[model samples]
Target: SGSTQCDKLTSEKTELTVTPKELTLTTENITATAGTTTTLTATFNDDTLNTGKVVFKVNGKTVKDENGKVIYAKVVNGQVSVEYTLPESMKAGNYTITAVYTSPNSEKLTAEATLTVAKASNN
Candidate 1:
């Protein structure tokens, strides 16, 4: 039996390179009253690729949406700011908020912020 033979071919591939920029995260308030709206901002210098894809989590849960969905805020000028009202039932304690930014090349950076929830006074 005669069979057609194929030649093996090999080519060199180049790895694209990019410079990483420092990503910073901050919030308008380190403390908030129960059921009050607060804001958190994540900034990336010259990070046009992953700025819009930033995801924020509060106490291990995503922040945003009326139904408490995982989508919140939007990217503008290499930054995404999220405004959310604290849960009324939230206990008076320290809470954690985290923001993660992942690049197109799969490189990721994460930053965290703390929020102190004050108990509502029964005045």
Candidate 2:
């Protein structure tokens, strides 16, 4: 017995839209007095699950909690924040604040901002 078979192939063109990833860091309190606490916020913009942690740094030094452990803030709805208290003895000047975002499904992103610390009040 002899059998014959025929195959047909079809293709369709598709388009994909790509956008650059972005991360922004800012301070809720742009200026804070020494010995006072301020909030650092990080927001991630990407096409993936935006749940991750943020590592904060000040003046090129990693910020740590009182327990001597690295502080990591949980990201919710693409935003995360942590409180940082300016040292009482810190000089009154501008400081560079940086935030690094880490996630299991996305590449690491970083952002920087400036914070001005004022001299503590003498009240």
Candidate 3:
């Protein structure tokens, strides 16, 4: 039997491209009065692929419940919302309402809307 020797082989380089995921938020301007509850909906681009939590803010401040607990809305099928009740002491004016979203593997996304608070009618 005879032994054979083979030369070294070289391969060409291959290139691959990757794209990052994106998220978008949408919300509508709403009007409400103190002591009244309003539904704030935050819709995302992907209907079935987004998973995260949304935090609602007003006038650059985080929203809190009566017990002073911060509110966090969980993303469900790329949509999440909260029932926000205007505080009785809230002044009647246009407030900037923002919804901030955060996920484990996604960049933070934000949306803003104007909240028009009408003066509570004295009844």
Candidate 4:
């Protein structure tokens, strides 16, 4: 049998930092029907990271509000959200909603969500 030697380990304070470069989007319900409204939220490493604009898109096209106006989400505090109304004429199909967060330097970070549209009600 051999005796083992004991060694002391030292501890040091460590700080970890991360730079956010990715943007993500999420919704409570990904599936929606035509003529219905849904909410989408975009998130990033920092809310203040976006200093320019957060453009929202749908089906590779820009989304509009109930007033038929284009909508853009601005990061307040750390996140941005928007409400979009699906066109009553929208056909039943798979659609993609995207959020493009633009930085002050023109670098764009994009996030997207999916929407499965169903046929409108007969009533």
lDDT of 4 by residue, 18-109 (tens): 98565544433377888888777776665465466677888788877667777877777667788877888889988887888776778777
lDDT of each: 0.72, 0.77, 0.88, 0.73
Q: Please list the residue runs of candidate 1 whose C-alpha ends up more than 4 Å from where it truly belongs after superposition.
A: 1-29, 47-51
Model 1 lDDT per residue over 25-114, tens place: 544337888888887777765546344466788888877689757764555677787777888889899988888766556666778888
Lowest lDDT 10-residue stretch of candidate 3: 1-10
Question: Model 3, range 38-105, lDDT digits (tens) per residue?
Answer: 98888998889457899999899998877989999999998998988888898899999999998877
Among all candidates shown, the one with the greatest lDDT? 3
Per-residue lDDT value at 46 in model 4? 59
TM-score of 1: 0.67
Assess every candidate by TM-score: 0.67, 0.74, 0.80, 0.67
* Model 3 ranges off by over 4 Å: 1-21
Candidate 2 per-residue C-alpha lDDT over 1-123 given as tens digits, one digit per residue, 9 for 90 to 100: 744575665889899899855555444336888888888887665434457788988989988988879998987777788888877888898988888877767667788888888877778
Which residue ranges in model 2 land beyond 4 Å of their true spot?
1-29, 46-49
How many clashes in each structure? 0, 0, 0, 1
